[model samples]
Target chain A: MKAVGEESASQELQRVVGAGRRADWVMASIGLAILIVAMGTLISVFADLIHSGWPRLTDPDFYTNFPSRRASDAGILSAWVGTSLVMLVTIVIVIPLGVAGGVYLEEYAPHNWISDFIEVNVSNLAGVPSIIYGLLALGLFVYTFGMGQTVLVAGLVLALLTLPVIIVATREAIRSIPQELREAAFALGADKWQTVRLYILPAARPGILTGAIVGLARAIGETAPVITIGALTFIAFLPPAPLQSDFPYLNFEWLNAPFTVMPIQMFNWVSRPQAEFQVNAAAAGVVLMIMTLAMNGLAIYVRFRLRGRVQ
Target chain B: MTSVDAVTEDPLLVRGRIQPSAEFLTHRRLADRLARVLLAAAAAVSVLVTTGIVYVLISESAGFFAHVPLKEFLTDTEWTPVFENARYGMLPLLAGTVTIAGIALLIAVPAGLALAVYLSEYAHVTVRETIKPLLELIEGVPTVVYGYFALLFVTPLLQRIIPGLPGFNMLSPGVVMGIAILPYTASLSEDAMRAVPKALREGGYALGFSRFRVATRVVIPAALSGISAAFVLGMSRAVGETMVVAIAAGQNANFTFNPLEGAATITAYIVQISMGDLPYGSIAYQSVFAVGLVLFIMTFLFNVAGFYLRRRFREVY
Candidate 1:
């Protein structure tokens, strides 16, 4: 009778375990399906954009002409130029400031209320909607600084949106460097500056680059802040070329010139009731996505390499 | 270590300063002090950004409040700022925001958590490595691209199944926003789950639990604080998401929760007024700031709460 009871208990355990395995199979597949759905959406978007946007690409002028009322005449000249210029401006501002801020928090700042204040407020700033950044630029840059709605203002706004991302990323990278590396440098009588300059920055390079690339991608794709700063929705004209016809060939006037970006241009096109404009928007999207994917690929590669080494 | 110590103990070097010249040392000290000040200034920029955002939103919105009673902005149901008789009701936009954002969270939280479970618990290392970057690549995709996908692909597909679904319904954008935010949810949750020590899973297994039970009942509970952090961050993202909702969820400020209808969120409303030819200092222009202030506060609270949860419940190994 005791042996029979033991056998029945064994059977019960088998039954429960089998049920769990079945549940696991179901749950795991469900998880995979979710991933596939994500990939499916991405693949479908790529295919759809290419299918619709490919025809426009054959016309080299598609990359050269300014926005026109007629879809047949429209190209992305002003839009692309504005985007590149704004990115350049953003890069100049964000990298040094973001890296410095990150370094201070990670390596130098004390673990006190002031450091805590900066960290918490930075996260909060990161969470503020892109549009609110636009509002700040509007009030601060456009009105107070008297910059008007120019490329510089838009660039500044995007930089603010990306600063928190870079700071957090930099800190994470700096944190991952084993403490022993720093201790060794200190033991050799290296000052804090020498230790950071000689070892810390070099070690954190890959992580910092990954962060900058990701942040740059974000700044490129932003729309709301640029819009809030009152970037022209319709710009048939390009900003004056830095290489100008005048004696001072490097023009500074374009810094304050009104601008439009790729996403904003796409937005304006999509808003038009014309069926043709929809195709143009699709084409513009393909271009925008290509830029984003390129940046993302570089960042992913950097992170992948870093993980292999750092971990 | 001995070679370095022997060099340090050399009679001339041991007595001398670390650097060659006193002038150089003074210069170096000045540079170090300068560097610290610069770093501090750089760090302060973030604080300034927050203060600037708050100040700008409040100052502009205060003008809006002075024009329209605060009670009316809160209680009224209409949001027809551009109509012949402009009514400044905040609810319609909010209703639309809540509906799309709610739908987005509903879809994202479950799928993202399950995906996190798979990556952390079940998948092989190779599989995890291959899929992880691809998943995060979705996060890097521009919101505007998601917007177009929703409007162009998902909306048409949904309309085919739901016969009377509006062209610009909340459903399509809602789902697409979930897809857009999937990385944030899944990545955070995966990190949290992976943080649960191996011994805990072994403990569950030693008790005769299967991998599934070990993950769901034992592991997830251990990482609840982190998972909650993910949930809050996801909510914040859903609320602030602008492009997809603006493009696919219609420009009309509909005061309904039905997923089949077109509606405008606060972000969408900002897009609408900005696109129009609103003269500077116009009431409509200021109203967008008012709307933005609302969006700002909502996201701010969620983010701080999420941050606190992460700090509070983070399990140390």
Candidate 2:
């Protein structure tokens, strides 16, 4: 009877172990299925965009001509140009401001309540909806400051939007540099600015670049804030030339000119009832997606290759 | 010993050699101080942004409320601000936002958590590294593109299966938005789960626990705080999302809980008004700010809650 009981107990143990192994296999498969489903969605979206937009995407005229009532004649010249100018302004404003802010927070600020408060504010700002930034722009830039619905206002809005991203990235990059580097610089009698400028900035440059690209990629696609500030949907004329024939070769007139970005142009097309407009929207989306994905891919590559060198 | 004693005896020479000139030192010190001040001011821009957001929302909302009572704005079900018989109630938009976000969470929570678990536990390092960036690429795709996908692709597909589904129903956008937000939740939760020490997993296995059992019972519980933070942040993201809903969900402010019907969200409403030419300071214009204030408050509360959860339940280990 004792032998029989022991044999049954052994069998019971084997059965439980078998069940656990089966369960593990089931969960693993389920996880893979979820992953496949997610990837499948991404692939299908790309394929669909390509399928719909191939003709227009191939057309050279699609890149050069102004938007027209005729779907076949319509193009994204003004939209792409506006997006480029806005991005240029945004990059100019954000790099210095975001880098300085990040450097201060990570390297200079004392570990006190004021610093903590500023840190908190940065994180909170990151979570604020992109549209609310639009509202803020509509009120503050467009109304109170009276910047109007120009390229500058669009630039400023996107700059503010991109600020938190770059700052966070800058801080992370700075933080990842080993403490010994800072100590060594200090030991050599380098002051704070000298240490940061000489030792830290070069090491952290790749990471900062990655952050800037990511931030600008995000900013380029933003439509709500630009829309809220009253970007024209039907502007056939381009902003004035940046280079003048007169004494001041560089013109500021483009900054004050109204604009339309790629996404907004896409939005305009998508909203139209015509089937051909949908094709245009898809074509524009494909272009925008390429730009965004390329930037993100580059950023990832930079981080992957450079992250090890710092540590 | 004789050389050291001679050097120590020449106090004036030692002082002159050790210390730089006051003029040079003063210039360097002033430059450093100025840089510090400038950088500090740069950091303060974030604070200024927050102040600007708050002040703008409040001041504009105050103007809106002066004309329309607060009671109607909250309690009323209608939200036709541009109509001749303009009703300022925002409940329908709120309902639409909640319903879509709820559907989004339902899809994202399970899928995202599963992805997190798989990445943290099952994926090889190479696989994780390769897949993560691609997954983030899903997020890096503009929301506007997602909106187009919802309206052009998902809606058409859904119509064949769900009879009587409107062209601009909430279900498609909500689902796509879930997909859009999935990468965020998955990556963040994976980060949390990966932070859980390996010793804990080994201990579980030593106790005769299966891999699945260890992951579900031991690892998840240990990483609960971080996973919860990810969920809250994802939730906030879903609520704040504008483009997806505005494009796919119809602009009609219908007060319905069902996902089959079309409805306008708070974000969609803002976009609709902003697209048209509404002069500044008009009640119609101020109304957008009023809705924006509501949006700001909702997202603000969620962010604060997320922050609190991260801090409050943070484990030292």
Candidate 3:
């Protein structure tokens, strides 16, 4: 677009040489510094947390006992237990619905407004502030459904919160499969359902697993909706084991049991005035951080592996 | 059809036939139809969630306006919804939210852009691969944990360096919020910058521009709309950030521009109110919905703008 003659090129070379070289180099150095400092904060945050929490974390009682007025006596047994239970329920609820929704949108839904509506709304739901989900749960689950503030209700809310992500991710995974596989299946007299089940899904399994794991990771860390569901800050008792004395042994009374999760426990500690509780909060945070980052790392690894295989 | 049927009758050609037994085919068809209906119903759940959110927010907030005048809620300087002489002014909370977001953007934008530039242009594939997932490790860390980090570690650090920094100030949370959002901004903007054709870089190099100059002036300008969208989206994340501000940025609702002061956000206010057992449909209870309504409208607008900008720029490429 600019003057491109040989004379102009020489002139431009001189112009760039005089001032632009130093400025650009300075900008690049700044860019490097920015990355360093950005990552440095993460390191320092974790370092400080580990430093403060390390001594207390080694104590067995930290995970064996429950919340206590004395921070030294407080632990996270119920919190961790409840978190796993909630995550389990959420996974059970979300995977089927999310995968089905993804399958439908990718394979079955036609070029129409219902498809468009579902697609657009799902993406938008991905952007909604999770606290709004808390409000929705407060109104819908805790009151409207009369589920009370229980493990099942909390799990359902978190499931709702992550449904969009799973759906969107699953759709992306499904979309990555080649069209020819479906066509070949169809040519062999496979119906839409059979083609999807026999050909596309198996090929898409790695991608779908990647999405589901990532989505579950998010559900595990979510706090706002769980808080809104009124998980107790001082949960001294564990929910009943998901079984009974009878031969069938399956019991859902635990579903209605009050619960607390790691994040909530950490929140309670951080909010306290006591200095010891701050350390306690730090310890819990370090544990929670490890859990979340490990989940994320595994998800990323799975995704990377999938991409390698796909190509 | 006749040819296919004739082929199916031949023992040697049976395996190649498209159709199986008629009875089995009908049964499979029925199952397929039923399964399609169920899968389609699953797809409809996302729409149901959207409707449920809209219905709850609207229906609850509808009764809030009957008591608090809309003009006062918007314009009044104070927000003391729980105090005896209560003022339901949204400005104080809005100011806190905007101020934190503003401070957060000041930190995140330049850092994010720089990180994007470094990642997109400077780093090799292996280096980028390793570093990127680590950054996302930051992204995936729970906000509550970040809140704790800001409150205990950062606030103390700030106090040591900057004399008289408040115990519960906005600066730490805002800064942490920036750090929290770095991955989103960096990743999105890098995607944009990378999408700028390599020809642009070559053009700059052909014109005697250095790598840095080519990256900054050439690729960045080309991706400006997408970069701006990332910044806007990051700002939206800051505004909606809950536990960090609630934990680190003090819960006192104040009308102030100073970053050193304590203040509450719309989210914090909701959290604070929820700490109590407010009876359903009470005026105070209704106020949470009203605050959420404002928050929803604010974020919704920003998200729409970001989405539109990303789309518009995407089309150009």
Candidate 4:
């Protein structure tokens, strides 16, 4: 009777194991299907954009001409130029501010309420909708500071939107450095500034770059805040040239010039009732998508290299 | 000889005083102090941003409230601020926002959790590495493109399945938004699950548990706090999303929970009012700020809650 009970127990264990293996297989299959669906959506979105936008995408003039009444005549010259200038201004503002903010939080901040308040503030700002930032710019920059709806205002808004990203990235990168490196520098009679400038910043370069690029990539595609700031949807004129042919070769007039960006251009086209305009929207999208994806791809590559080195 | 020894042993003797000039030391110290102040100022900018957002929203909304009573703003169902006979009710927009966000969360939470589990527990390192970046690429796609896709692609497909479905409906945008936020939720959840110690999984295995059981029963429970954080953050993102809902969902402010219907969210309303030719400081213009205040409060609460969850249940292994 005792031997019979042992045999039944063994049979039960085998049955359970068999069922568990089948369950694992089922879960794996479901997970694979989910991943494939996600990737398939991405590819299809790209293919659809390319297919619809092929005419404008292939045309050389499509990149050069200003917006026109005729769909075929319309190009993204003013839009692209405006986007580049705004991005240039954004880069100038965001890099130093984001990197410094990140360094202070990670290295200099004492364990106190002030640092905690800043930490909470940064995360909260990250969650605020892009449109709210536009409202802020409308009230603060346009009205109070009298920056108007210019390239500088757009840069300022995007810089603020992207700041938290860089700060978080910098902190994470800094955190990953071994504590022993800082200790060793201290032991060698090096001050905090020397250690940070020489050792910490160099080691964290890849991660910080990745963050900055990612932030810029996000900013480039943003639409709502720019719209809120009242960016003109139809801009036939470009901002004044930053470089001039006369004395005082640099011109500051463009900073105050009104501008439009790629995504806003796309928004204007997509909203048009005409089918031809929709085609133009698709083409514009293809251009915008390429830029953001390339930036993101570069960031990922940098991060991968950083991970490899650390490991 | 004794006098010379006494001079050499003086604590304040000129030991290396010539090697490093006092002036140079002061300069270096000044530079260091300057760097710290600049860095702190940079950090302070974030606080200022939050302050600016609050100040703008409240100040403008106060202008709105002085004209439209708070009760009417809350209880009234119609939202026709742009009309000649303007109505200040915000419930319809709020309902639409909640409906779309609810739909989005329903789809994103499950799929995201499953993706996280697969990445953290089942996939090989090479597979995970390749797939993770590709998944993140979904996020890199702009909301405007997703909006385009919702209007042009997904809506058409859905219309064929359900005849008489409106061209602009909440269902299509909500679905696309789910896909858009999936990477964010999945990546965060994966990090949380990965943080669960290996020893726990080993213990489950030693108890005759299979990998599936070990992951679901052991790892997931251990990482529950982190997974909740991901869920809340994703929810916050879904609520704040603007362009997709604005383009795909109709511009009409519909007050209903049915995903099949078209509606405008608070964000879509802001886009609508601001895009139109509203005079500065007009009632309609100030209404955007009022609506923005609502959006801000919703997202703020969710973010603070997520932050609290992350800190409160942070498992120190």
Off by over 4 Å in 4: A1-7, A308-311, B1-19, B313-315
The runs of at least 3 residues in candidate 2 whose Cα sits more than 4 Å from the true structure, single-residue gaps closed, are: A1-9, B1-24, B312-315
> Which digits, one per residue and each the tens of the lDDT, describe model 4 over residues A1-311?
68667778878888899999998888888788889888898998899999999999999899999998999999999999998999999999999999999999999999999999999888888888888899999989998788889999999999999999999999988998889877866765456776677667877788899889988999999999999999999999999999999999999999999999999999999999899999999999999999999999999998887774642
Could you give candidate 4's per-residue lDDT for residues B1-317 as a string of tens digits? Answer: 12224323435344655444566557657878988899999999999999999999999889999999999999999999988899999999999999999988888899999989889989999999999889878998989999999999999999999999998899999999998999989998898888888999999999999889998999999988888988998988999999999999989988888899999999999998878888998999999999999999999998888877676556466
Give a tens-digit lDDT track for model 3, residues A1-311. Answer: 44655458778768768677777667768877877887898888788888999878999899899888898999999899999889889989999999899999999999998787676677668778888888888877887788888999889889998898888788888888888767767776667887777667777778888778777777777777677656678899999998788977998888989999999999999999888998999899888988887888888888787675543
Give model 2's docking category.
Answer: medium
Worst 10 residues of 3 chain A by lDDT: A1-10
When summed lDDT is taken over every stretch of 10 residues in candidate 2 chain B, the lowest stretch is B1-10
How do the residues B1-317 of candidate 1 rate in per-residue lDDT, one tens digit apiece? 22335434534343566654566556657878888999989999999888898898898888889998988899899998778898998999999999999999898999899999999989999999899888877888888888888998899999899998888999999999998898889998998898888999999989988889999998899889889999998998899898899899999988999999999999999988877778777788899889999999999999998888777666355
TM of each candidate vs. truth: 0.95, 0.95, 0.93, 0.95
**TM-score: model 4, chain A:** 0.96
What does each candidate score in C-alpha RMSD? 3.3, 4.9, 4.3, 5.3
Residue A253 displacement (Å), model 4: 1.0
Q: Each predicted complex: what DockQ?
A: 0.58, 0.52, 0.48, 0.52
Error of 4 at A25 (Å): 1.2
Q: What is the TM-score of chain B alone in each candidate?
A: 0.93, 0.92, 0.92, 0.93
